[model samples]
Target: MATIGTHSGAFQADEALGVWLLRQLPQYESAPLIRSRDMEKLKPLTIVIDVAGTYDHDLLRYDHHQRGFFETFDGENKAAKDGGRPDVTGPETATGEFKTKLSASGLVYKHYGREVLIRLHPSLSANPDALDWVYRKMYEDFMEAIDGNDNGIELAEAVRYKESSTLPHRVHRLNARWNAPKDGPTEDERFETASALCGAEFGEMLRYIVECELPAREIVETALRARTAVHASGRARSKRYELERRHGLPAEGLVQFVLYPDSSGMWRVQAVTVEGTAFTNRLGLLEPWRGLRDAELVARSGIDGCKFVHATGFIGGNATYDGALAMALKTIEGGSTSVELK
Candidate 1:
C-alpha cells in the first residue's frame, strides 16, 4: 500500500540502486514507485529517496544534495560541523575522512543492506560474523565506488587522462544521446534501461561475495590456524588430505604451495594458485631450482630427492616429505640461501 518516490527525468546509478534496494524489502516488494519532484505528490509517499530537499531518517527521507550534510555508516562524523576528525576509527573511516559521504544508494545500503543480503541468501543469516564481514566487505568492494561517484568525492589529486569506461559512465551512456533521433526511446524507457543495468551489476557483485569470496575466506582461515601441524616451521601446509572434502573446496583455497605424499610413496610439493583462480602463486619456489630437473636440480639445491622447479617459478616437487618441507620453508624464508635440514 506504500509508495516509493524518487526524482523524475534522467536517473543516475544512485537513485536507480536506491529504488532497487527498497524493492528487495518485504514491505516494498510490490509497492508502487512514483518519480516526481512535486512536493504535493511526494508528501503522501511512504518513503522518498534522492530528491527531497531534506534528509530526515525518522521520516525515511534520504537525500544528499543539501548543504552541510555529511553522514557516515558508523556515525563517526554525523554530528561534526566540518566532517569531524580524519582519524576516526571505523572500517568506513579506516582509509580517510573524505570517504564519509553517503549518497542515496549508500544511505539505503548503510541502513538495510545487510538484511537485503540475508534475504537473498538465508544461509548467511545463520552466521552473524560472516554476515557482518560480508556487509562491510561489500561496502568496501562495491558500494564505496557508487557512493564516491555520486557524492563527487575526488579519488585522486589530479588526472592526466580521462576515463570513459567506468560503470557510472557506461550507465550514463544508456540515456538518449544528444544526436538521438526524435523518434528515439522516451526518457522513461532510457531510465528503465539504466536501472536494469545497475541492478544486474549489483546482483552479480552480491552473488560473487556470497558464493565465492566468503567461502574462500573460511578455508584460508582454517588452513592458517592449522599450519603448524603440516610442518615444524609452520611455513608449509598440505590440505590435500585434510580439507579436501570438508568444505567441498580445493586445497588451493589457502596455501601458496602444498606438500603432500604422492601415490608412488614420494612426497611432492606444488604451488597453490592464488585465490584458487589466479595463475600466479601466493609464493613461488626458489629461483635456483627453477627450470632445472633431476641431476641438475639435485646438485644445485643440494637437497636429496630434489625434483624439478617450474621455469616460471610457480611450482616444484621433491621425493620425500622432509625435502618438500625444506623447499617450502626455504621459499618462505626469502630463498636467498640454502636451507639446512635437521
Candidate 2:
C-alpha cells in the first residue's frame, strides 16, 4: 500500500508538468520521431508532476541515447535504425517501452528490480491535463489504502492441514498470537477470534480477485445476461447439469450469502458463486430471466456474467450457442426416517 510518491524519488506534484508540456509538442514541430521494433530497447522515464505546482521545464530533455515519445510517425529519427544507444545503463537503470495494445502506451519503468507499466485510459487521448489528474488521483487512492487497510481472517484454514506449518494452521497460530483477547475470558472467545480471522482474510482475498481484477468494462453487458441464466436454474439437478454442459462450468465451488426474509418467507440471495466456468454455464441455462422476483438474484447474476466475461477475456454473444448434452448424476440417498415410519 506504500504510495509511489511517498518514496524519496517519487515524482513531485509539479514534476509531471514538464512531461505534459513535452507531450503537447506539435507533430509538425520537429523532425519525425524514431521507431523501435525491439520494445526492450526503449527505456521509460516517469516524472510525477503536479501541474498546479511551481514546476516548469521541457517535458523531455535529451537523453544521450537520443530518445523521445513519438508525436507523429514519419519514422525519421536517426537513432531509430541505428539501434538507439543506451541512455543510462547501470544497476539502478534498465530500458523498455511501457506499451500495451489493449490500453495506453508509454514508457515502462524499472525500479528496484520491479517492472511497472505506466498507462492511461485511451479516451484520455494522452492529454497532459488528463494524465496529471490520473497521477494525482492514483497517488491519493494509494495513500488512502495505506491508511485504512484491513487484515482479515480466512475460512479455508478450517480444512487446511499443517506439516509443522500449513495454511489454516499457520493462519490460526498468527491470529492467536496477534488478536487473542488479553482478558482471557472464555473458550468461545478463542474460537471466535480464530474463526473471524480466517473468514475475513479469505473473504478479502476472494473479493479482491473477483471484483477488482475481473469485470472489464467491455464485457460487463454480456456477463450480466449469463449471470441471469445461472440464477434462474435454482437447485434443480437437471438445470445445474444443463448449465454445466452449456457453459463448461466446473463441478465444484461454493457461493455464500446471507438470507433475507421476504413476503415468501426467508430467501437466500445469490451473492457470488465461487465456481468459475461452471457457474457461468449454470447461469447460462436459466435464460429469459423474466418474472424473477428476487432483485438481488437478478442483479447478482446480471453482474455475474460481467465478472466471468472479464476474467476470461473471450468475445462472442454465442455464450449460449456452445451447448452440449448433460450427463446425469447418479445418487443413492433413500427416503427420510419419517417416510419409513409412515
Candidate 3:
C-alpha cells in the first residue's frame, strides 16, 4: 500500500493541489495520506511534499522552502545548469530567463501533468497534440499562479494597485481562522477542506478544457484555414450563424469580429459581442463614422459600394466582398485609411 505525506498544519494551495494531483494517478488513487512534519512519521511514505527539506525527483521528494533550491519546469537550476539556454523559458510566463521558482504543486505538475490530464480525460490520451496543448495550457492558466504566488515572484511591477483576488489567496483563507471558535475544525479537517476546494476547482478546469475550449480550438483552426476563402486579406471569420448552431462560440473577446455575406448579397462586417453574451462588438466602427449611414459612411471610409455603417458602429454592410474586407482591415488597423484597398 503506497502512502503520501505532507506537513500537518494549515495547507496552502501548493500542497493541497500536489496531493490531489498525486491521487489522480492509479498508483496513488487509494493511497493513505499521512499529514505530519516529523521526519520519522514520513519515512515510510512513498512521496513527501511541501515539508521535506530536500527535492529529489528520483526519490519522489518535493519541497521548495530549502535555501539555494532553484528548480524549474525544464529541471533544476536551469540557467546555471544549462549555461543560460535560450529556449528554457516558457512562452506562458515570458520571464525572459529560465529557472522559475517552483512550488511543490509545480514540481508535481512538471513531472506528472500530462499523465494526470490523460487519466482525467482519456480521450485526450489518443491525441498527442491535444494532450500536449492542454498540459501546457493548464499550467499557464491555473498552475503558474500557484507557483508564482508560493515563490513570492512579483507577477508584474506595481503599476497602480495590487490584485487581491488570486487563487492562492483564496485557498489560504480556507484555513481555520485565528479568531475562530477554540473548538473549531482541527488542522487535519482544514487541510481536507483545502484539498477538496483545490480538487473541485482543478476538476472544473479540466472539464472546461475538455468540453468547451477544446472544441472551440477545432473551430478556430477551421476558421484559420478558411480565412483566405472568407476574404483575400486572410482575416479569420467566426461565422455567427454557423458557430452559434454548431458550438455557440463566444465571439467578443475570443474573436475580434466576424465577416459574412448579408442577405442583400452585400458582405457584412459585424462586430462581435464585447459587453455580454450578446451581439455587441467591443471594438465598434471607427469614431468618425459612428453615427453615419450609407453614403456618409462611404465618404468617411473612402471605400465605394458601401451600404451602411450602424450608428453604434456595431455592424457595417458593404456591397462587395472587397468593401467588407476593407472595412474589417481598416477597423483592425485602428481607423487607418492608409491601407491599400484592392
Candidate 4:
C-alpha cells in the first residue's frame, strides 16, 4: 500500500491555523479569517483537482504537542479537543506547559518500496489555494523522495489512509452529481441510457450485449409489422401510438420504441434507448418497455407539423386512427397531404 507516516506536530499544526487567525494576535497576517470557534463552522471552499493517474496513500502522524503559549501545526488541529498527549510519542508534561489545543501531524506515502512523509501546517487548509498547492507539492515530493531512496520493499496497489481513513464526502457528492440526469437526448433518450449501461457492465455482463442486440431488433421489427398490418386491415382505427411502452414485452423496461408513419407508405420505427441495451425481441419490442412506450410509437403520432383545426358544429367528425396514419405518412413521404400541430 502507498502510505505516509509523520510525527504529531504536523497534525496539530494543521488545526491551529483557524484558532491563531481568529485570535487577536498580529503575528500571522496570512492566517484564515475564521470567526467561529467550531472547526465545522468554517465555510468549506469548493475546489476541483485532477488526480487522473495517481491515487492517494495513507497518512500517519504523532499526536503530541510542543511546549509553548499556543501554536497551530497544520490547519487541522487549531483548538484540539483531546486534552493531553498520550504515551505514543514523548513523555507527558504539566497541563499548562504547552497549549493542549493543537498537535503535530504528518502523512506517509508508501511509494515503490520506501515510505515518503510530508509535514503539514495549519495555514494550508485555511486557504483553498494553499491547501491544494500543499497537497500537490507533497505528492510530488513524496514520489521524488521514494525514487531517490528505496529499502528493497515492494509497494502494493492500494492507497491506505493510516490516520483518519475517511475520504472527504465532497468527493462522493461530486461523483454522484456528475452521474445525475440532465435532459432528454435529441435523437433517442433511450439510446443514451443504454450506452451508459453498456459502458458500466463488466466481464461476462459485457459479452451478453452482443448476443442480445440481433434478436432484440427482430422483435422490434415484428411489432412494427404487426402494427402496420393491423392498420392496413382496418382493425385499428387510430394510427397514433403512445410514445411509452407497457410491460407486455420482457425488455419493455430496457428500451423505448416509437412507430410513426410519414407521407410515404413505409412505416419508420425509431429505437430510442441506451447504446448496448437496444435489444428487441420478435415482437419488434425493446427490452426496456416498462409501462413506457418505445420510440417506435412516435411514427404513429399523427403528423410531424403542428396546426389547429376549427370546429364547424358538424356531427360525428372526430378523426379515426387509420385516416390519421395514412395522412401523416403521406405528408412525411412528400405526398400532397398537409397537417399541422398549430
Candidate whose TM-score is highest = 3
Model 3 lDDT tens row, 1-342: 999999887778999999999999999999989999899998879999998797888999999887556776665664434566534443343333334578999989989999899888999989998898788778766887888888888766664576777667778998888799989988878887888888888989888988998788787668855655765544336633434435444442234457778666888887765432354454676768666778887898898877887766777888887888778778877832221111
Error of 3 at 248 (Å): 29
The per-prediction tally of clashing pairs is: 0, 27, 1, 116
TM-score list, all predictions: 0.69, 0.18, 0.72, 0.16
Q: For model 2, where is the 10-residue window of minimal lDDT?
A: 323-332
Candidate RMSDs in order: 7.8, 22.7, 8.3, 25.6
Better of 1 and 2 by lDDT: 1
- lDDT of all predictions, in order shown? 0.74, 0.25, 0.75, 0.26
Taking the tens digit of each residue's C-alpha lDDT, what string does model 1 give over 1-342? 989999997788888888888888998888898889999999999999999877888999998777556676545344344467533433354333335577898889889898889888889899999998888878877888888898787766796588888778888888788899999898877776777777788889989988998887777567756876875554466433224445454433344467767677767777655442345565667877789988899898878788777776766778788888777777776643322211
Ranking by TM-score: 3, 1, 2, 4
Model 1 residue runs over 4 Å out of place are 78-98, 156-163, 233-328, 335-342
Worst 10 residues of 4 by lDDT: 309-318
Which of the numbered candidates is closest to the native, going by highest lDDT? 3
Shift of residue 261 alpha carbon in model 1, Å:
14
Cα lDDT tens digits, model 4, 1-342, are 111122111112122211221122222223332222232332131110011111122321222223321321122222322454332222133233321222221211212111111122334335554344334343332222222212111233464444232121111222223345676332223322322332232112212322343234446445644653644432222211221132232232222224445464434333332331223211222222212222322333333322211121000111344433443333223322111111
Task: Report lDDT (Cα) of residue 311, candidate 1.
Answer: 77
What shift in Å separates residue 194 of candidate 3 from its native position after superposition? 0.8
